[model samples]
Target: MAKVQFNDVSFSYGDKKIIQNLSLEVNDGEIMGVIGPSGCGKTTLIRLLCGFIKPETGSIFIGETCVFDAKKRINIPPERRNIGVVFQDYAVWPHLTVLENVKYPLKKKRMDKKQMQEIAMNALKQVQMETYANHLPSQLSGGQQQRVAIARALVSSKELIVLDEPITNLDLKLRQEMLKEIREIQKTIGTTIVYISHDQEASLELCDRLAIMDQQGNIRQLGNDYDIVMKPKDRYIFEFVGISNFVDVVAKEDGVYINAQNGLVKLDDKSVLENPTKAYQLAFRPMDAVFDNESPIKGKVVTETFLGNITNYFIQLGDKQIRLQQSALDVMKYGKAKEGQEVGLKFVRKFYYEKEEA
Candidate 1:
């Protein structure tokens, strides 16, 4: 029920800077996802928000409480922050039963045994684990253990719930089920959840808003799923979200001049043409590109993988490889493409990225 805010936060380990001056806000009852590659500052940010690591030069606010303030030299302890954290490894005590694990957090309060048991059972049922209340952690499966962990967090009724790669260890089927379950639980209880993961696709699908962080701990982009996937702002982001084919071309007054094509390809967004002298990288999604029989652009299919509904083709044109994902039905209409087959490719939608200065 609380909004989390980080204002100009910066954190470092010894002399190595992990998180730079970053500011982000998660609205009350919102599920915000934090995604990045390995070694990025995703976990560090969680630690800072939980009050385990204090920012060197900023303030963090959880609802009305100023949990951390560098200038004022104030740092609130984790227990007082009223935040629940579900670690990547479901941190359940092997000796404790499902009910005991959920009731452990409530033991800190002076609630009677009967009341605690009722609350704990309710939390377990929330996660559909009430039937296994007497089962120890060692007897339960990984997914069951995860359910116990979530129930433990829910029993506290904290303001913010941070799930660090909660479904990473689960199988594909179990992951999907857990994803839906987590969303349902959050919506049912109206608790603000922050999902942290390295998988861009899962984060994009699960979160209302996303924050993409880089290896250097910089926030590369922040937006909804469509914006981040379709129109990436940077080269790093373009390659991270999905497969994209890049073509090098020079910008002109009228359009982008493709040296290989020896013709101008008109772009919808003319902003990249501002720097007429420099070359820009034009990117388009594989699914957006279509194979045309008459188009001059040609490539040899180096590899093709059948994935039931869609077939992914890796075509080599000169030295560059362009990936195209064609629907199985479309392939049937056109004709199943084989390796070493010469195909004409044309992009229906494209985006441009400015060349980075060396």
Candidate 2:
């Protein structure tokens, strides 16, 4: 399998800069997910890697080969790069049978029919589509069609594959099944994958490592799911990673305090405040906050939603509303808080950030 590397990569579209001085590496035999909001250069990054578009500045390497170098003026074409691509649309030819679709990539090598069939069948087997080899894509489900696309990508013995929102078109159940299938196939073949998506849940569940990009086309953070979620580098990363609540708080000589519905409530930890005189935001995940009757911080329950496994609560503290989540088991034990109920809040995990501008 090949490792992909981008060194000081910068790309622009006319006057608009999409990426700037971005450097990231995808290790061999690992699923590296690049996730961000829409128009965050995720697609542009993939296009640059696949040689569809050249970067304004920087070098790209696949394994040991320098596929692109601005200074050296070396660029290997996409076909020669031996990189497989599975797009969001499945890209399976509707007219062709599953086996034919898988064999299509091998045809350019001028292989004999028997050898091509053998390789194609092997690829289909890897994706568990061998039984439906003769079925046309129109006859297959969306998930099945996606498998055909993946098999086609793998048919040419491609060690590196790029999946661009591959499961976005599938239903929720199909997405989960496809994710499991992909992880299994990766383990079986050890292909280095570069997964591009805006879905935080999918990327967190599938990727070995994640690269978070911002709208400014910068790599904000790169790490595992746990680190990126629990130890976010900044407020942007925290907010992007999951459902987050940010409450405005003022740092005083006594301690950091939030303007609760009752009055000012002192935070337990004063060390998190960066400046004693400035206002900051206390950011935490919905799951990290709990209702505690003894805590001084108070909020009125604006709404409570039972979302299957968890009970979601929107608590109004002063003028700001923040979300909190409780497990169904906890709700069963302690009973659900009613609307308009004034509840005490205790934050289990929180981070401080400069208050956002109005």
Candidate 3:
């Protein structure tokens, strides 16, 4: 419906800077997720987009309208921005019925009572909460209350919506169902959405593209889930996206070698390292490594954990402990390794990164 753009936006709270020279664009009719740990300014971005706070520099655009521009001195109020917001707590009025809550936005425009009722009922139907229009939020379940809040937001602004950790309080099953429902609604109406959350897995499941932020409030990477997970741009991205293992590695005349408990074990694939002369560490995901008896790379199994879908193995390589995962099917095919067992490791895929300073 509408594309959102932030051009060289920067914000600060007194002496502490939150965002700096951040530029990003969200395409029309797509779900763009902004994910990062707490204190990374995810909420600040939402506030800036909603016109609740002014940026120290740069401009922001929604579709063709310049909502906020520091140089141009153009500032649009939040009420006039026509951006809907859904919060994590399901910000529904407990006193009002579902229909009344949805109609509250239309009341500000002084639309006729009948016309407002019709629009509100239509929005309720869109979220599949039509039958409970007369029910109060207190009478509804957590999921149902969320649906009411979503309907209210839709009734207010159909073009652009911001969902800030909307389903974080819900149970696991309810969270999944809510995500599915949101996707269905988006597909049907083609509303551009900005979903902000710290949950990486949920963001991956719901978003079309993800923007990952670091502690300094800078976007480290922005791409699809596969690229962010498999082809991370830096060590921070790799460690933040999923479970990762980093082992100290040294380059030798023969090949690259991983520092092991017994001695240095030569890596099977020397081509993984782009620059063998520079200091680098071997980095790989838990699912990327496999136990091989013939491989020279070895580790002692410190512990083994049986998760429902996958088996987790904690292997001690020298003094550092790393994790490896095997699916249930894999365990059925190849027997599980015992604790304290010396196992040979072969990496199916690996990356080399310079060690970060402490």
What residue pairs are clashing in model 3? none
Query: By TM-score, highest first, what's the ranking?
Result: 2, 3, 1
lDDT of each: 0.82, 0.88, 0.89
Q: What is the lDDT of residue 43 in candidate 3?
A: 88
Overlapping backbone residue pairs in candidate 2 total: 0
Residue-wise C-alpha lDDT for candidate 2, range 1-358, written one tens digit per residue: 9999999999999999999999999999999999988888988998899899999899999999999999999999988888888876546998999998998989899999999989999889988889999999999988888888988888755689888875355788887787888898899889998888767888899999999999999999999989998899998998899998888887887778898998888988757576666668889988888888888999999999988899999999978999999997677655689999999888889999987888
Cα distance off (Å), candidate 2, residue 57 = 1.2
Deviation in angstroms for 226 in model 3?
Answer: 1.6
Q: What is the C-alpha RMSD, rounded to one decimal, of candidate 3?
A: 2.1
How large an RMSD does model 1 have?
2.7
Segments in model 2 whose C-alpha atoms lie over 4 Å from true places: 166-168, 332-335
- For each candidate, what TM-score against the reference? 0.90, 0.95, 0.93
lDDT of 1 at 106: 92
lDDT of 1 by residue, 1-358 (tens): 9999999999999999999999999999988999888889898999999988888989999999999999998899988888878877656888999999999989988899999999999989988999999999999878788888888888776578888875455776776677788899888988999889766777788889899998999889999998898778788998889776887766766666543332443433445565666668778788887777766666778999999889998887655677889897668656667898887666777877776665
Candidate 3 residues 1-358, lDDT tens each? 8999999999999999999999999999999999988889998999999999999999999999999999999999999999888875547998999999999888998889889999999999988999999999999988788888889889888899988875355777877787888899899999999998777988898999999999999999999898887789998998888888999998877778898767887887746567776788889999898888888888999999998999999999977899999998777766689999998888988988987766
